[model samples]
Target: MSSDFEPILMRNVGVAKAADLQVYEARGGYQGIRKALQMSPEELIDEVKKANLRGRGGAGFPAGMKWSFLPKERKVTYLCVNADESEPPTFNNRVLMESDPHQLLEGIMIAGYATRATVAYIYMRGEFTEPFHILQRALNQAYAAGYFGKKILGSDFSMECYIHRGAGAYVCGEETGLIESLEGKRGWPRIKPPFPAVAGLFAKPTVVNNVETLCCLPHIVLRGAAWFTAIGPQGSFGPKLFCVSGPVNRPGCFEESMNITVKDLIYGSKFAQGMIGNKAVKGVFPGGLSMGVLTGDELEMRMDFDSPRKFGLLGLGTAALVVFNEDTDIRDVLLNVTRFYAMESCGQCTQCREGTGWMYKIAQRISLGAGRREDLDILVETTRNMGMMPGLSICGLPDGAAFPIRTLVEKFRAEFEQHIVRQEPGKVERVLRVLN
Candidate 1:
C-alpha cells in the first residue's frame, strides 16, 4: 500500500492560527462555497451522488441519497450538523470543529443549499466545550465575512447557522435523537417512518449529517466528483480520519484512504507507528467499542464498510481503533465494551433498557472470575432475546449494544471458556499466569 496522497481535511491542522479565517483562506478555504453558490442546489447534490460519498458517522449511508429523501413539498428544510462525537476512543470531529471551523461551516452551507434548508444547527456534544467556543467564534467570523448570513458570498441563497451544546449523551449521535436534543428535550431517538428527511428537527423536513460528512462538501464542490471518486474504491471513496488509541506508540489521528488495511494502520509509520512496548497483539477493537474486536490474525482485514463483515465484525465504525497487546485479558475486554453500551442505552425500549445491563453484568462476572459454564450460554442467548432487531428499538443503540457482545462472545468463546475451566487448582493457577 504505497502511494502519494495529501491530507484534505487536516491540511491546516498543524499550522499556527490555522483556525483563523485568514489562515484557512490562505490555504484556499471557502472556494467550494463560492463555486457552490454559483451552481444549482440540484447540481451540488448530483455531484455528491456521483462521488458516492457515504456518511462517515458509522452508518455508512450515502450522503446524496440521504439528502434526496427530503419531500419535494416541504415548507421548511433544516440541516443539523451532528458534532456529537461521543463514541469512545473517537474524537476526530473535535479537530475538524476546533481547528477548521469555516471548512465545516462551508460544508454546512453547501449542504444547506443542496437540501433547500433555511436554517442549520450544529448539535455539538457538551464535552466539546473548547471546540464549541472555537466553532462559535468561527461562526461569528463567517457571518462577519458575509459567508454565513443573508445572501452568503453575495448570492441569493441564505441559511442561518447556530450551535447547540448537548449534555454529552451518546444517543444524540443518532440523527433523530440529536434532533430531539436540539428541540430542548431529552436526547431520545425518535421512531422512524417519518425519517429525518421527511419529518425532523421541529417537525420540519430535516437532514442530520455528521460533522465529517458535511466537511467533505466544500472539496466535492470545488474539486468535482471525478476527483473525489478517484481517491478510493467505488462505494468507499474519499479521505478517512482514523483515531488510533489504546496502548499505541504514536496515538494520533491519521488521514488516509478507505482502502487502507487494519494491519497497515497499526504498523505503518505514517499511522499508529506500531504498537507500544513491542508486545504481541492479542485482539483489536477496530472501530471504537461498537464494532467488535478483530483477533490478531485478522489484522489483514481491509478497513472499509464491507470488508470487516467477513470476519464477523461490524463495518468500519467511526474508524477509531483501540488496540490491546497480548498481555490484555479477553474477559476484561468484553467487560469494558459491554459496560459502555449498557451505560449509554437511553432506556427507551424495554429490551434495550434491560438487556444492556444484563449483558454488562454477565461480562463483568466473567472478568471477576464469578462466571460459570452456563453463563456463556446465557450470554449468547441473551443477545437474541434483546430487542436488537430492527424496528424494536427507537434507534440502533440496542443493535450497537448487542452486535459487539454477540460477536465478542461468539468469536472468543473458547478463550472465555478457559477462564471458568477448573482442572486442578495448580492447573487453574498456571492457566491464569499464562493468560496474564
Candidate 2:
C-alpha cells in the first residue's frame, strides 16, 4: 500500500505544541465550525448524510441518521461525546484527544450544532488522566476563544461543553451505559424502544457519538461531503485510524483508508512494517480483542466495516489489530480473551454474566492442562446462546464476548485439541512452557 495519502484526522499530530489552541488555530482549526455555524441544522445533517459518515464507535451507524432521529419539537438536545475508549488495543481516541484537542472540540461543536444540542458532555474514561487534563485545557481555551458560550462566534447558535470522567467501566462504552454513568448511576445499558435520541441524559433527547466519529465532522464540513466519500470504498468511506499492536516491527496507530487489507497493515512499510523477527503470523485479533480473530491465511481480508463479516467477524470494531506470532499459544490467547470478558461483564444480564464466567472457567481449565474434548462443545454452546444476536442479553456486550471465544475455538480447533490431547504425563511442563 502507498503511504502517499495525507492524514486528515492526524495532520497536526507530531507537530510541536499540536495540542495548543494557538498552534491548532494556526493550522486551520475551527474552520469547520465557522463554516458549520452558517448552515441550518437541517442542511448540516443532510451534508453528513450525503457524506455517509458512520459511527466509529463499533456500531457503524450513520451519524446524520442518528442525529435525524431527534424529534423536531424537543425542548433540549444533549450531545454525549463517548470518549471512553475501553476496547482492548484501541487508543486512537486517546491519540486524537491528546495530540489535537482543538480538533476534537471542533468536531464536537460541529456535531452539537448539527443535532441542535445546547450542551455537550465528553464522557471520558477515568484512567485517561493526561488526555483529560489536555482536553480540559482545550475546552477552557475554546470557551475563552468564544467558540463555546452564549453566542459562539457572534452567531445565534449557543452550546456548552463539559467533560464527565467515568470510572473506567468497559460496559459504559455502550451509549446508553455511557448516558447512565453521565447521570451518576451505575453503568448499565438501557433496554431500547426509547433509544438515546428520544430520551437520554437526564431523560432528555441526546446524541451519543464516539470521539473518532465526531473528529471526522470537521473535515467533512471544510472539504464537502463528496470529498469525504471519495476516500475509501463505498459503505466504508473516509480515512480510518488503525492501531496495530503485538510483535509488529512498528506497532502504533496509523491513519489509512479502509481499503487497506489486514495483510497490508501488518507488512506495509508505512504501517506495522512486517511482523517482528520476520516470523509467520499465527493469527490476528483484527478488530480489537472482541471482534474475533483472523487466521494467518485470512490476512488478505480488507480492513473495513463490511469485509470482516464475510470472515465471520463482528464488523470492524475499533479497527485495532493485535497480532500473535506463530510461536504464540492459541490456548493462552483464548484464556486471556475469555478472562477479559468474564471480568468486565456488568452482572446485569444472566446470560452474559453466567455465560462469560462459564467460558472463562472452561478456557482456564483447558489452558491449565485439564482440557477435555467435551469442554470445547460446552464453550461453543454457551457463546452461541448468550448475546443480543441470540436475544439473550440486554446489550451487545455478550455478543462482543461471544464472538472472539467462538471464533477462536472454531477457527483454531486443532490447536485447542492439541492442548487437550497432550494433557498427559508432560502436561505440567507443557502448561509451564505456555505460561512462560
Question: Which tens-of-lDDT digit does each residue in 1-436 have in candidate 1?
Answer: 7947799988888889988898889989989988988889888889999999999999899999999999988878999998999888898998888778888988998999899899999888888889988989988888898887788777788889889888878999988889998998988998887898988988889999999999999998999999998987667899989888878889888888989988888989888888888887777788877777788888998888888788877678899988889888888888888888888899888988888888787776668675667877887787777654645777887777776788778877888878878423454344445555
Clashes of each: 0, 0
Model 1: worst 10 consecutive residues (lDDT sum): 423-432
Each model's C-alpha lDDT? 0.85, 0.93
lDDT of 2 by residue, 323-354 (tens): 99999989899989999999999999999999
The estimated TM-scores of all candidates read 0.95, 0.97
Per-residue lDDT value at 265 in model 2: 93
Residue runs of model 1 more than 4 Å from their true location after superposition: 387-391, 422-436
In model 2, which runs have C-alpha deviations exceeding 4 angstroms?
425-436
C-alpha lDDT (0 to 100) for residue 249 of candidate 1: 86
In terms of TM-score, how similar is model 1 to the real structure? Answer: 0.95
